[model samples]
Target: MEKRQLTYKDAGVDIEAGETLVERIKPFAKRTFDSNVLAGIGGFGAGYLMPKGYREPVLVSGTDGVGTKLKVAQMANVHDTVGIDLVAMCVNDILTVGAKPLFFLDYFATGKLSVDVAADVVKGIAKGCEIAGCALIGGETAEMPDFYPEGEYDLAGFVVGVVEREDYVTGESISPGDVVLGLASSGIHSNGYSLVRKLFFEVLGLKVDDYVEELHSKVYEALLEPTRIYVKSVLKLLEEVPVKGMAHITGGGIPGNLVRVLPEGVDAVIEKGSWPFLPIFKFIQEKGNVPEEEMFKTFNMGIGYVVIVSPQHADRARQLLSEMGEKVFRIGEIVEGRGRVVLK
Candidate 1:
């Protein structure tokens, strides 16, 4: 008997497959490139020229993952849109500070690399970058045997954006009378999926394709609706109006995320019925018997982003956002109190 030596391929790391993936994704990534992207894909590090227009440029950066929503994508055999969720999670966070996203990178890891599935995911990421108007400069794809089960992969996204120091929306200007406006979410927008899965799988035992009259679609479609990217509308608003503060609703929900930008001695009071509640949320609450408070603190509950503006600008802001095709809601207002979020 002879012992054979092992190569990296024998250990399940396919350098060739990664190289092929890089080739497949180049055109897609190139579509998202602007003049500032200094280099193309497959580089050791991405290069970007500092945008020339800002008088006092401040680089803003954020990183995030799709959370367990990736599991929903895996179960449904839907690999494309979670990449959008990945980009939305990070870019939306940077948008909170009024930054315009400049470039994006991603990390993909799996036990086995399926070229088709990986390509589909990266195409979605590139599409997301196009929608957000950012360049996809570089990414990492790792095939680690035993690290992830076959047909399963995890994704993470990183984004760098820039804003002038004078234009950063820090919420410091959020005064007692500032109005809180809510932007309707596209379905759940990628949070609270642990509970969502528990309700749909454990309690209700619903399959991805199972139809519910309430959702008016398959169970997985509603659950996997890609996270909404508010960058365009928010960026436009920042240019015309002085947004006192902005909050991108994510894992912690409206109250959880909104409080981060509130000034001391001020609280936000959200009206319960100010916005049209999406049916999926009602279905979840009724089926799971989830508490009302938990619902506000856990899910976007239809509101994906919030804008704080002075009373004079609230109506105009709502109008501008609506004209931009957003579903806007005048949901709340700031009040004098210890920094807190109040859902009335």
Candidate 2:
């Protein structure tokens, strides 16, 4: 017989590496497990049990990727926090509809798998799921050599949640003089990094490893800080009050996102200087001379989210959200218009 050799590595996928990673992450993933979880790591399908007595229970699902912000994570070699960003991006959208996130799954793809790095990513995901009261049921790890260059990978997440049909929130009741309440973001919540990378690395010659003016960590760390999942606090308030509308400020920032839930002929007028924006935004604007209009269109700037509510409910909403440690503000009011968001 002719000499023949067979190798798993030769086919460009690392089975052993994937196995080691699953082993490393198994313990951490189990930390977020609850009674409903039906499968462990490496399973083909994740399983969960829906709770009983949720009248007219509706399933709310959302999936999102980290966008080009992954470039900053790869540049900083910081894999841990981006995993939280991945989960938050998906889960937060579910919350906008007054849903409770029940379970989550992730997909990580890379050129060559590193057990330590992949575990770091999973640890953050587990931490997020824990905080959000959701089970980390299962995930996928793909190692492809040709598709992605070495040391580069992408992350995506899917979240499923439940909401009673009677309690679901939409801006159907939003009317003129309804208050626009702003919630401060921890930092940039995993959006608009395409221009950020260009401004810092390409235009200004700043390295991701270098510390900028006010930020204590590398530029990438400040930018790559994980997405904040607001499911817990917001869901708590939903149980007590009707949240007329909510906006998740992501790629299109305030103008595009806040207008998403506005009823026709209702407008949101936001005060430009109501909440303080983080220093990073100023740094990029000064360095790159990016226009104010483009910045608002592209980045979240200062506010991560805004809740549209009746003026009567604004004070109570702020009080409840403030009790949860969020800096809430009365940034604007609704007015008569045709699906418009005005920054005053």
Q: Which candidate is the best by TM-score?
A: 1
After superposing candidate 2, which stretches have Cα over 4 Å from the reference? none
lDDT values for all models? 0.92, 0.85
- Residue 283's lDDT within candidate 2 is 75
TM-score of 1: 0.98
Cα lDDT for residue 2, candidate 2: 90
Writing each residue's lDDT as its tens digit, candidate 1 over 1-344 gives: 89999899988888898889999989999999999888979989989999997899999999999889899899999889998988999999999999999999999999988888899999999989988999999999989899998788999899999999988889988889889999999989888999999999999988988999888999988998998899899888887888999999988888899999998989999999999889999999999999998998889999999999999999889989998889999999999999999888
TM, every model: 0.98, 0.97
